[model samples]
Target: MPASKGSRNAVSSAVQQIVLSPSDADYLDQLIPAIKDAAHSNRTAQLLQGLSQFADNHESEIEGVCNTNHQEFVNSVNQLLQVREGTVRLTSEILDLNQSIQASTEKLAEHKKALVDSRSVRQNIDEAAQALEDCLEVLRLTNHVHDLLATKNHYAALRALDELQNVHLREVPQYKIAEMIQKSVPAIQKLIAEAVMTDLKTWLFRIRETSQFLGEVAFYHTELRRTRQKERAEKDPFFRNFKLNSAMDLVSDETDEFDVLDNDEVQVDFSPLFECLHIHEALGESEKFRAEYAATRRQQKDLLLPTSIRLVGDDEGGSLSALLESIAGFAIVERATMKKAFNLRSTVDVDELWDSMCQSAINLITQSLPDIDDADALLKIKGVIALFIQTMENWGYSVAALDSFLLTLFDKYAELLKQKFSRDFLEIVSADDYMPMPIQTSEEYEKVVNVSWYTPEKEQSDISFPCVLPFSQMYPLCCIDIRNFLNQFYFFSDDHFQHPSVIDETLKKSLDELLAQKVCRLLVDRLSSQYLGQIVQILINLEHFETACVELEQLLLAARSPASAGKSVALNATEEFRSNKKTAEKRIFELVNSKIDDLIETAEYDWMAPAAQTEPSNYIQTLTRYLSNIMSSVLLGLPTEIKELIYFDALSHAATMILALPLSADVPTINRNGVAALALDVQHLSQFVDSLGVPILRENLDELQQTVNLLQSDNSDEYYDVSTRNKKYGRVDPMNGPLLLEKLTQGMQSSGRTDKYTTLSSRFGKK
Candidate 1:
């Protein structure tokens, strides 16, 4: 009735390992009985008929039970199947992993075998290297032996050399070459000795450094020394405070220490590492001495470097410098201590230097002389002066160094200019090189003039020489100062001789005059032989431009007086009341007219008229309208608002004469005073004062003042003087019979007075 040992073992194992909850225990309790009963019933189905019958009698119950048990079994079987499927997959994967492990194990074994084979091969190579090294040693020994044999048995030594050559280590070395070089140049041996000494010094320095390092390490290993050093490093704020800084800060400032762990102290470099630098510095000092030795060898080798000088027999800075040194010695004794530094080649003769310089300067001066029309030469001279200044700068010479030369040159040029401009003017020239000169300005000039003649070298005066050169204005006039050769030729030209001036006087006059003379063919040009037009103009000024009447009276007075000069008269009928030059006339006339208009009160209209007229004499103002007509005539061919007036008979006759004469001739005209003179002539006229009837000179007038108011009278004769007196229009008795007769006869008796002397012809006339 107790469980078997195996079963008990299995149950214990299941409890520990199988992991079933209480629910699984319940399921198994129901499942186990159903399984057993089914097995038993199937086994005894024929034998237990009665039992079977009983079972059949409760078949429904049994069937229900079977159904419940079967369902429970099916559920249990499905869960078991899923668990089995998972176990199968896991087992298959384990089998595959085991196979992979076996294959990897085989490969690892093969690699281990290969590694062993490689190690063996490497060992063989190491043995072979040793053999090769031994062979090289033998060859080196044989070479040494061969070298000894070379002197005694040369042929045998050659045979030994052939054997040595077949080996790997018989190649040439620098030591042998150095030995050969030493035989030729003993200095090479000295160089080798020095190199060996340097290597020895390196080993000695290394030993000293190792001893010092060991001593330092020993001191640090001891507790007391270590504590002291650590204390000192801590106590010194500079090293003690040293701590981690950011990498960025260390990069920005080299002194920043990210980890200042380096144990080296700030002290002079010592031993092998620093000894190498010291050796290099020592060698550098000897390089100058070696260069001299090299120069000597270079002579034997016949080598040349850049910047070398060539000589006839030899070419060397050293040899040439040596020769100069010898010459300096000789010169010192013969010529009293040399004025310059020694050892310079005599490419140029010292004795001839001044002469050469002076001659070159003279040639330059001559070459720089300006031609009649040499622009390029002038540019070249300017370039030379620039070159001189640049040369002075390059030499760093004193201003006084150039002052004397400049003064001499300027004086010579001044003398040349004096000769050049002896008979003409000096033209001031300009240069494109307009930079301010270093030479004295006016202030400096005054300073120089005030300075003592014998000033110290440092205080030498800068004397400014006033210079002359050519100038070109926007326009060239005869007044322009003459230039060189062109001016020389001009001064001797025929026109120049006529004027006895150095320039073309005519060219200086004006383009207006030149053009007018050429165009008008006026009397200004007629004076090629002499000046008749100018004389005539002068005489006209003296005559003061009289009116025809005044001029006539003048001619008459001359005719009448024995004192009146005949030399000035030309019975011109000239009636030259015309203007002289147009500009002269226009300017003077405009100015005079402007002045008169400013003074006159009655000038409501323009002082001149728009057309030619010969009416409105001044007597019309006082006597007649003739003066206005004459003035208007004189202003003919003038500007706008200018005119001349004449009556129909006189104008028609004048027009005919104008047409008759050549169109070129300036027509005659009257003047202002002539009108006055004519009025005077009428009143107190020498030619025309009436003494008896039909005895005076002939005259006529077109217009008169309407003072009488005549048309108002019914009978002109009855209302004349008596009616005027009755009206009492004026102080005079105008209507008396005799007065009336006198008035009526006045119109007839005075030939100059018009018929309508008192007639009212105007729209606003009093009549």
Candidate 2:
């Protein structure tokens, strides 16, 4: 069949398109499949066209597969041939080796069996040697335990037994070694316990010996005598008539003396108990020893005093005193021993010991307070507390526990004393006195004053003075009572009046405040029942108020710390009284100044009055006398500034009067000379006003001198000018006018000329 031209052309174009564009070739590839189907059904010549289009679409893919697959197949066939040849040669060698292995199989099996048999024998030998070594170690430990027991070293024997217990002997069940160890442990522990018991007995015997030695010391003889004498004095009615020294007495002021005792030559030996206590601690049986020691002390005390009545019975007094002395000696020695152990045992708890000691002391004091018949029991308790504190210091502890306990005890005891004895003290201080009552005058200007004996009084009877005891005696007694209260537990001596180191600073301040409150109470009770003026008068009878201040200051210095002495509330109150009087003086100056012009205008005669007139009309003299009271007892011992201000105030008043005097018609020279004299008196007073002191006072003095000079000047009109341009224009305004500078500055400011005077001084150049 010949192809049509159109079909041939289509085939050529399709081929070109497929070659130019692969996407178009993909489209032709799809169309070629369908075209082939159509050509196969319709025209076979078109199949060739479809075939050519399909070939064009997949030409590169077909060439790549042919090229890659052909080379890969050829290389794989060559490798397979080589591998097949090697396998044939290896098969021949493997068959030959198999024949050789089959020939030697029986010999190799015998060699393996021989090696296994030798390894088993070596393992057995090692097991036997280890067993033998373990058996020897067990036997050695057993022998060591036996040896230690024979030597009576119980602790070492116990340690050996403990070591043997660690052995894990798991031999045959019939073996007796483990059973024997289990059975021997109880017997060994028993032996060690018996040995410890025997050691404890030996130490106890030594402690008894040490206590006996302490009991034989000579220091107790003086203590016994003192106790007996105190007992007798308390019982005797004649002794009761006189006041006994308090339990806390340092010394008696009435005696103005103190007795001294020589140092004792004998001392107790405490070393044996010290050693015993250490041994007990090491044995872990300190509590047991302490219990036993307390029992022994009780037994000895019971044997010494069989009955309670024997304590005071004269027939058995000597025995009772000896028992007390013995008990005291035992306590001291025991404390010393405990102190030694406390110092040595750094790990021992000190709080426990301190609590025990403090509780015991507190119990003793609390139980003994109700039965305080004499100083004997109190003295014993005091000695115990002091010795305990001393031991704490010796043992190198803080000792704050014992100190705090004593403070608590002292507070209760002081309260007891205050309740029982304060009333009697008050009774003694409330005695009646003959001090006259102050009289008030009808005149408004007169200060209230005491009546003169020369005047015939409408009421002849005198008002009773409020206080009974003089402060001179009262202060000393109060101090004594305070000393007795404070020293009971504090151990203050005559030579050492300072607070003991055992009392903290805060506690000391508390005690001082308490005493101050008591003394102030006494002062209030005695002095407050009267008028203030009368109280001052009463104080005047006893001593000068300044003297009282001095005495109080001294008492405070002796009683407490110097830092607090001056600042005490009581002393500050006294200072407040002085301050109040100073304020009153200032108010009185103001009062006198208010009436100065009126007093000057009404005077009929010369300002100076005759000396014979006890009550004068001269207001200046009255003011002078009133002010003199400020320098006298009212403000005595006050600060110097106060006094300076007082004098300056008087100077200012006199200067004001001199400057404010109007031009009077009658007795012009009299008025001028009188004012001049007043100014001269103020100038004389300026000598006492300390020119180099406070600036305000010095300035006042300078003002007063200028006023005095002007009043006495020949040309007074020159200074009287008020013009701003005048040379003498700056004088203080006369007749209560405003200051000259104030006047001139105000006038200039009103005229809007303030800047005119800004440089006035530089322009004028002092005129």
Candidate 3:
């Protein structure tokens, strides 16, 4: 097996050597595989025999193949021989080229050494040339910048300075002239800034000169714009839709019209302003410029106001109008200047300038306010301020500051009116006589009613006047004064506020507080302290005052703004007036009771000695006469309820005093005569009270009458039985029967009739 493997390896080596092409090698490799397969089958001899026969058959083809490969190998050998010859030739050329390159590098080194020796000198010469050119350019530009600054051409001067610094100076930093020019660059910039600012200042001065005309033009333009806008809105479908959908009605009913100013009418030169703005912007100092501009305008506006305020009228209305107009005019000019110069419609700095300008006028107005005392004059000033505010609003300026000022002015006006009304009220009340205001003629009566806020149920027919007037017309003179004051107040408020149905809530609240705290309180205090004797007249006056307060309250309610229409506002003044009326009424009863007390104290009864006819005592007669005098005098004019109350209380109090007299410690004992006198006085009181037509007063005296009857009776039991049968004497106690009988017996014994009283007591058995 080993010999056969060695034989196969030998055959493979021989075949690989003979087979030059890849395809012949592949065919020999296939023949090896077949010989291996034949050897495995023990047919290697047969396979070798077949291979020999195949070689014999293809000998010529094989020889031809050998010849072809040998010829191609010979050709490849010749090609390699040719390549070797070319390489040898190329190597010889490279050697020659290397020699030539070494010679060229030696020459280049000599040239580089020569160039290196002279390069700094050439660079120095070029630098010197550049420096010369740059110095000339710097000097030229510096002179040109100076000339531009001289001519107020700041923008061109700034550009030249920029060229000197960025282009020329950078190239020649070592040059002294360049250094000098660079050092002076800041100074040049400052010069340009100063020149621009100077131009601005001059422009501002020119603006000041033409400020009034400019203001008129601006106002005319604003009005024209507004007119155009309104016309456009009226024609616009979207605006029409908005108008139809909006809840608020149009503010004005008149046609939207304005007088258009001709463009040729006003010619303002804004070149200097524009130049200044451009220079400042180029300098990157726009904020600084704006601040300076605003400050300068503020100073100019402040100078427009007078140092000392002077009133042109009672409220300084005219002077205020003039000051506001000047402020508004200047403000308009400044606004126009801002738009033209800075192209700014509005800025924070500009708004601050306007605020400061308005503040000057506001300060003047505030200073002038304290001296003005009239509400009407304040109203006029308010109208002027309102117009100013409207004008400013139409000019597209904020009226917030002005609106606040108006509110403050309104407060001051309301306060002034309150003070005025309070002063008037005090004057009227101080001069009041607590007497019925006499209306002698129909004309006088009508005038009083008209002035006194006396609203009658119906108009009176024209007729002859009567001497006696109704309660409404019979109020004191102060009522008419109050009415006059109210009329003036309403007129002033109507004029000032200009609202259809409402005044300011703040004003209304202030008025209410003033009426309650000052007016009603003043009247109440005066009536309580000083008018006790004039109670009846005071009641009539209070009634009228209360009615006037109601009218005033209704007016205030009707004048409420729509926003506050549903809100409830309690008028303390109205209730105060009614309270004051009640106070006056209570004062009447107090006066009546006080007089009764005084009359009762003056009475000195003779309880033991008097045995005369059954007539009323001196105290009772005096009290009755006093009551009758009061009923005929002050009480006659009072209302029926009050009159009856006063008279009835007086009589009741008087009867109580007489009844308590006999039981007093001062009157230790009383006899039949004293008892009879007491009974007569009580009867007189009852009859007097009855005559007053008050049954309640008569009923109140029944207790005293019953005690009097018990005192006058001989048999206590019989009297008790008779009085018990009558409800008029029910106030007399049956338990006091024995005590009364014993007192009677003591009185009789004291009068020398002790035995008769003892017999009566025994008969009655102290029942």
Candidate 4:
């Protein structure tokens, strides 16, 4: 292949020289032009030539392509120019930033130098301030040193000290002065001892004289203390802290003949007078005794007064200005008796006079009672008490003493009622008229029962409108008087003693005079026969045993469900109870929070107004409303059951509703209710119970009279009592058992089933 190639190359070399010539190159170029003519001569050639020609004619295409290329080139150049512009801008920014960095560096160096200079200046100021503080401390210490250098002239030494240097001076209290001196300045104790010795030397003789005087003073103090009279001198601690010598020291004085100190060693027997304080107030001679007591008290007061007191040897007519020299002086005795009566000296603290009076009254009532039911007998007993009380007052008994005596009796009777009420199983006795206050309006009455009444003469009745309140109701008023009387003792100095003997004597004399006089005896006889003794005694007894303790509890609890019980129930507001109840006016409106004031104020005492004139149901309902709502509440708040009875109608109505529910409730006469009618038949029973201090119900059960005729026993009949063992407490009482069961069964049938309490059964236990 190489040889052939070489030969061809040799042969082609000659041809190549011919063809490769520059002229040949030019002829070829011309030949290509002639070929173009030939190509035009043939049809095909002509077609090819036409094409070439067309190509020449279509030069716009190539020119267009060239234009396109040029445009692309310009676009690239423009993009490159944009890139170059951005790079130049970036370079200029970098240069500016470098310049700014250099300036910041210079400023930073300046600021650092300034800060260092400022810190140095601040340090210098601090050093100056520290030096000033040190100077002040030095000055303070220097002043303290000056104060410490005290001289024998204590006052001068204090003045020489600098005020600012010794800013504080801590004083030792007297109690610790010795210890403080020993702790801080031991030499001060020696100086104190020397001063004490010097003081002893200067006042030795004077001290002796002073001691003698103090001994006399102390003797008086001893007398005062014995009678609690020292309270006048030593109202504060000043007396105890006094420099006076004690009486014992006075007694030890060396002087036998010329002793200045009083030897008050004579025993003073004040027990005899004090003993009189305990004497009974109602021995028929109460008036005489009270007078004696008053006089004795006045004398004691005058004798014991600081100005009146005289040493036994120093007086006769010397210093003794006799006020009540005799023990029978009225003023002294009266004051003492009054103190005991008024509770200025309480029964517990003063004497048994009050107790004795109470006992006497109780004994009279108990002894005089013909039967528990005989109220007339009770009235008689009351008359006696009134006689005793009034007689004492008339005989110069202190008003306070009389009041106290009455209050004691009232309280004692009230307690008796409570005891009886427990047996009757009554919450309280419900009556319209209480002992001290009576009712005004019959509409206010819910039931009917004869209230404890204080009837004045017909002439006095029209204008007087007098009412009696229960013992409890009267207590506050009485207490006010009693407290006032008692508080009077605060005005008396302890140096005085009150005597009661004169009052006793005066009271006895007065009684004798009254007894001897016919007019007074007639008055007592008339008043006593009607209202005084037996009736009140009986009422107290019946109330206690019949209705006070348990029944009241039930009534109160039932009252809580006002909506169920009936909205007319008088008690509405308990706020007063929680906040402490004030007067009736304030509590009445607030508690009811209704417009009942007009009705209450305008109410009339005409209980028998025809049913035709008034809506019978409405009247009954209104009456019930008055009773349950306001009156019951009033009674509940009071401590005495007797007051509750003041509203006799309300008491009976409520009792009828509660206790006599089993009876026909077809409203009978407007005048009376179930309990009221029962009370009429059993009025005497109250006296029996009162006399025995038992509940009427319990007593009646114990002595059950199968026949109606056997109910009342003669006065001489033997007394009997029933025990819970025979009729267990809460295990149905005989009188109530059958009725209660029947009522319960009826209640269940009438849709009155209860969840809390079970009804009694015939033969079952608690089931």
Top model by TM-score, which number? 3
Residue 481 Cα positional deviation in candidate 4, in Å, after optimal superposition: 4.5
48-105: candidate 3 lDDT, tens digit per residue: 4444444444454545655778775456445544644543453354345444544565
Worst 10 residues of 4 by lDDT: 708-717
Model 1 clashes, total count = 35
Order of models, best lDDT first: 3, 2, 4, 1
TM-score against native, each model: 0.17, 0.31, 0.62, 0.17
Residue-by-residue lDDT tens digits, candidate 2, 1-767:
67778766666564455445557457556445434433334533354455445554444444455477866545544554464454345334433433344445445667778778877887888876766666666667767777876775556665676666655344522347666756766675566555645555565455444443344342343334334445655777454322223332213223333111112533444444554555455556678766665555445434433233222223323433343334344444445555555643222333444344345445544554564433334344444444434423433445575566555544444444454445544543454232332333332112121211112223323423231222233433444454454554344322122244333233344434433344344444455342333343334322323333445455545655444444443454345335444444445455445544455454343432222122233554544454455456443433466556655676567555644442233322322334445454555445444533446755554554565555445444455355731444344445422232222333344445556333442343522
Q: Which portions of model 3 miss their true places by more than 4 Å?
A: 1-203, 209-299, 302-319, 338-346, 363-380, 455-459, 462-466, 470-509, 527-533, 601-604, 718-728, 733-743, 755-767
Error of 1 at 155 (Å): 44
Better of 2 and 4 by TM-score: 2
RMSD of 1: 42.7
lDDT by candidate, in order shown: 0.32, 0.45, 0.65, 0.33
Please say which candidate is ahead in TM-score: 2 or 3: 3
Each model's total of backbone clashes: 35, 1, 1, 110
Which residue ranges in model 4 land beyond 4 Å of their true spot?
A: 1-258, 261-617, 632-767
Per-residue CA lDDT of model 1 for 1-767, tens digit only, reads 54457644433433333223357565345323322332333322221232234334445454565578977545544544554454345335423433454456567779889989989999999976766665655455455544644343333433343344444333332335323422432242234335434553554334333432332322222323224334545677554322222233223335322211123531212333233323333344344433332343223222111122222233222333332222222222111112221221121323233233333433434443432122222232323332333222222222243333443333333334334433232222111121112332555434432331112123334433452111111002112322232243322221101122212222222212221232122222222322222322322221222232244334333433233334343322123323333333333334333333332223122111233234333322431233233334332223322221122223223222222221111312222222222223224221221331222112221110011222222344434455554563333223322232233333233434434434422211422
Model 2, backbone clash pairs (residues 3+ apart or across chains), number: 1
RMSD of each: 42.7, 40.2, 23.3, 48.1
Give the alpha carbon lDDT tens digit for every residue of 280-348 in model 4. 221133455445444443343333333322222331322221211121122223334345456323334
